[model samples]
Target: MKKRINNHQRSTIKKVMNYIRRYWGYLGMSIVLAAVTVALTLYLPVLTGRAVDLILEKGVVDFAGILAILKKMAVIILLTAAAQWIMNACNNKITYNIIRDIRKEAFEKIERLPLKYIDGHSCGEIVSRVIADVDQFADGLLMGFTQFFTGIVTILGTLIFMLTISVKITVAVVVITPVSLLVASFIAKKTFSMFKLQSETRGEQTAFIEEMIGNQKVVQAFSHEDEALEKFDEINGRLQKCSLRAIFFSSITNPATRFVNSLVYAVVGVVGAFTAIAGGISVGQLSALLSYANQYTKPFNEISGVVTELQNALACAARVFELMEEPSEVPDAPDAVNLEEADGHVALEHVSFSYVPEQKLIEDFNLSVKPGQRVAIVGPTGCGKTTLINLLMRFYDTNSGTIRVSGVPVNDMTRKSLRNNYGMVLQETWLRSGTIRDNIVMGKPDATDEEVIAAAKASHAHSFIKRLPHGYDTVMAEDGGNLSQGQKQLLCITRVMLCLPPMLILDEATSSIDTRTEIKIQEAFAKMMKGRTSFIVAHRLSTIQEADIILVMKDGHIIEQGRHEELLAKKGFYANLYESQFVNTSSQA
Candidate 1:
């Protein structure tokens, strides 16, 4: 079931509560412990009043009675501390466990999200929601559970205890405390919007930092350091402005409520003194009333601080929930069939699409390939060569029309199944932080050691692997940053070689390799694609000369199609493109 939360406080609160409800047993125990702690804490003041009564006159004091009261006070104090400690432990467990679940769910959501969503957002912004935002939320929620829960209980307990001592004094304290509420509420409203802006600016700053750090080499290469710093300063300045405003607004809450609290305390002291002098209450009773009044007002100070923090937490939680609740890639049909084996007859008909509605990229695009044809797609940049392959793999569904594999509409097949039948080697390689063998076995984890070595040899990567200290077992730096670009591309090819799927999509797969290795890889690919369907997207026209069919694409349309010789014979766009590459190469030579 797809669950969406409306952008309203009530709905957000409801969702937060739903998470808490999962750990209700611990929450219930924490609340019960809080109540017990408050009860003992409130009673200790009463015992102190009793001890004071016994010692009003030094010579007339009943030492035995005073001693008994002191002992009781000590026990109550100990129990109160114990209960509070236990409650805090429970709060930490609940808060962090919820954080763990939220992060897990957020990552799983990222996996299922459409490519359009991933393409639209910055990596650091998404990371902020999962890591920084969730951590902030956990801190605020822990505060709410630890102090906010017990603070309210303490306030209520003190009120009841105060009323028992003298209703007039209690009434006086009550009348003055609402002023604290008014102050806190006013500050809280202003802080919420300020904190929301602060959270957003923080995400932008994080994204900018990640971008600059990840591409530091490029920034240095093009002498973009100064410009990048100026941009960074601009973002940093905005973040500082938002953070200062949020802090300024929320900082007023505690002191404003504290001032009102002092007023309540002043009233209690003055009223209780009058009551003591008038015999309306004994000296000891008046002292207890004053203690209860302080206790009652203390919660306002704590809760005001909590409310300010909760505003920021709520803002962060909103971002995390938005990420988790985003509609995932359109789900496959309930009865979607899995293509265990495919003969690789692929077709696209009347395909029209665009990243944005106002601009079209591919329109009325049509293509058909037989079971074992080797098709090469050549195009200038932004002519929809890669986009066509993305469509074929169902990365982004076409705006209109249908793509099919083995005569089955892709929509009717499970994405995993459709992707499983095709081995893809993109120009941009991805390698995780693991052994070389691990990266190679990503497509076929259960492949035997011999299979892995054979694939590496076929892709000309075996010699490099042998030279490494630990061969295939050596772990890689993140994304294989330790290897040369050509070496990385070879490993990517090695990975696909192991998969040996019925179909293949090689998008500039050999663009990074040297000419010497390129020939070796071409020979390997030729043998590999002998009886399987293949789609090769390339810019170097010479590399694909032997392809069975050449598709020359321009402006999302196939302007020329035939064998390399036939296309050159026509002297069209393909002829000029093929000829221009050699002209540039000869000039460079």
Candidate 2:
């Protein structure tokens, strides 16, 4: 497992490097400026030591010479600061640009991903990958470029200067430095898994919150508030524990490395004093060597701190990469043809399908509808009615056999072109946060206002819409929260009415509306269905009495089929279903 994790981390790092390569100009400039800054910083101590030596040699202050050297050092320090500022600016540009591209690609990946992937993952988890994880990755890269680059340069440059002063002291510093490295490595190894766990728990918590908020009405309706709170607390407690472990380990790395660095500094100071007194090295050289020793150890402390952050960032990156790596939907065949001007003829030949391999939901499903025919399908729950619609729309391809529109196999036609011929309104209405007019025109983007209002009126939606605050221009809340369920359903139907495709599939589309409103909508539907191929999945048997053909399904097979009157006359499955519904309606009345 550890090896596999390391491989994933390495792959993510390589991908990040490829993004960096695109902005090589900015990176190259930042590197050059960082090097210049480090050089100037190291030279400042040398200049100070030289000034001290001049005063010691003469045993009298050379004020003019001292003043000139001090001035030069100040100028160099200012230039170093300026270069550091420019380097940081460049680093920010590179970091954010790469982050933008990463986010763009991740979103595009979501667009191309199959419905299967979306169905299996929680919305909050995917959202975390795109937003939170990407943000963390960007921040880490910014710190790495700004601090990591300069820290390494400072360490190497200071070591070189120390070596020129005295090889013995430099060797001691090098030997002691490894202790800090070992401590950082040990802490990082212990804490990396903790950070990864924390990230996972955080995503879980986020997902739970999103689910709860989305279904808050359901929870309240069922008086499940206490249960919801308990579940949230459990998830929150797990996240807190994971976070504490990660923070505890990360916090120890810096101070532990700093303690070892202090020991190195003490050794350097003591050894330099002895050498200076023994006439092995000058006082001025000793001063410079001491400064270099401090500079050399500083990077170790800074790097140790950054290692903790980088580990957490890598954990976030791993999650984002996991999302990006999911298998996308299969591409269309090379010779796929366009489904132009469909004649509304649909057929399913020996079609078989399953959401999972072990549990088949549709099997040997065969159906044929001539042009301009109205068909209604009725079945018990879990009898594959909706699954049939899914297969027809090519949202999920059949496991075997063929579904064809106008005698052309669905797989042989481009999915976009094939779907364009059908307009669908589902039981669960979906509306975005937009004006009423915008939602209605979604299916027909270039639709005129007059056409949109006309469609709304036909669906019996225009009257209520006009009573809203802004009429057709009224803006809806997310998922049409401001509208009643029935109103939302009407808008969905209005959207389909605007599209006016050659074929229609209505899956309990009028389930939310009252009987009176439903009757009105049904009257409109009757006229609309005249010249179109329509498939209705209805639970209320009365709605389909006028349908040209009715299919009664059970256990993934069509057990009965005929006109509603014919099926009733057969006294079989369809007759039993109709009688049950009729008796239930009578009881309710």
Candidate 3:
């Protein structure tokens, strides 16, 4: 399992590198500049030591020589500073551009993903990957690269300079350097799993928060506030534990590496003092060697600190890659053609489907509807009513057999073209944060202002809309939070009315509205369905009483099919359902 995880991490790293490859030229330039900066910095100690020697020679200060060396050193320092600034600018540009591309790709992947994938994952978790995780990845990369390139050059250049002065001191420095790296590596290994768990828990906590807040009304209605709080506490506690564990492990890396670095510096100083006394190296060379020793060990401390951040970034990247790797919706068929003018004739033959293969939701379903027919489906909540709509709309293809629209198999037509022929108004109304006019015109983007008002009037939404502060131009809050539920439904209905596609689907579209408003909307629907094939899925028997055909379903099969009055006369499942609702309504009255 550990090997498999390592392999997966390696794959994710390679994917990120591909994005980095796009800005290779800029990255290369940054590295070159960083190297030059480090080289200039390394030369400064040599000049300082030489100046010290010049001032000490024969106990007489050579002021003129020292001044010349100081001027040259100042020039080097200025150039180093300039190069460092330009290098940082390049690093920032590269980091931000790569993150921008990553965000763009992640969002586009969400668009192409199958509905099943979206339904199976929490919305908050998905959002966390696209926003929070990606943001963390970008920040880590920025720090990691900034330290990594310069630290490497400093370590290598310092070691080479030290070797030229005295191999004995250089050998001692090398022996102690491994201790710092080993300490960093061990702590990093221990913290990797902790950070991974923390990231996962954080996503779960975010998802719970999103779910709870979005359904606040339901919680209040059912008096579930205490339960919600308890659940939130449980998730929050888990996240705290994971975070503490990760932070504890990561906090040890820097101090431990720094301790090892200090040991190397002290040993080099002591050994170089002895070598200088023996005349094996000059005072100037001894001073330069001491400075080089610090430079050599300092990168290890910086690198150790960065290891913790990079580990956290890796965990976040793994999650983002996992989402991107999920299979997208099956591609359109190579020879698929556009559905230009559908005739509103639909047929299903030997069709079967299931959300999970082990649990069949629809099996051997067969149906045929002619143009201009209205078919109403009535069933228990779990008895394949909405599943049939999913199949017709190709949200999920049938597991076996085929569905045809106007004598052409659905699979043979492009999904966009196939869906364009149908307009749907679902029980759960949806409105984005936009003007009332924007919401109404979504069904037909190029719709005229006059046409939008006509649809709103037909759906009984005009009066309330006119009362808003800006009428049609009023901006809505997220999900139309400012509007009442019934009013939101009216807006949704108006959207469909504006489009008036060849095929119409009403999935309990009026469930949230009052009885009077429902009647008005039904009258409008009656007019709209005049020359279109309509499918109505409803639990209220009164709504489908006038349907041309009513199909009663149970256990994934159609148990009865006939006109509503005819089914009532037969006293079967449909009759029982109609009688129960009627009795409930009469009692309430």
Question: Alpha carbon lDDT of residue 239, candidate 2?
Answer: 90
1-589, model 3: which lDDT tens digit per residue? 7777678667878998998999999999999998999999999988988887886757699999999999999899999999999999999999999889988989999999999999899999999998888888888899888998999999999988888889999989988787888889888877777878898998998899999999999999999999999999999999999999999999988889878888988998899999999999889888898889888888888888788988888888888888888899998999998999799999999999999999988899999999999999998989999989999999998899899999999999999988889989999999999999999998689999999999999999999999999999999999999999999999999999998899999999999999998998999999999989999999888888888989899989999999987998999988889878997779989
lDDT (tens digit, per residue) of candidate 2 on 241-351 = 999999999999989988998999899999999989998888889889888878888888888878888888888888887888888888889999998879999999999
* Residue 324 displacement in candidate 2 (angstroms): 0.9
Q: Name the TM-score of candidate 3.
A: 0.97
TM-score of each: 0.97, 0.97, 0.97
Which residue ranges in model 3 land beyond 4 Å of their true spot?
57-59, 587-589
Clash number for each model: 0, 0, 0
- Model 3: lDDT equals 0.91
Better of 2 and 3 by TM-score: 3
The Cα local distance difference test for each model comes to 0.90, 0.91, 0.91
What count of clashes does model 3 give?
0
Rank ordering of all candidates by lDDT, starting from the highest: 3, 2, 1
Q: Is candidate 1 or candidate 3 better by lDDT?
A: 3
Candidate 2 — what's its lDDT?
Answer: 0.91
RMSD of 3: 1.5
User: Lowest-scoring 10 consecutive residues by lDDT in candidate 3?
Assistant: 1-10
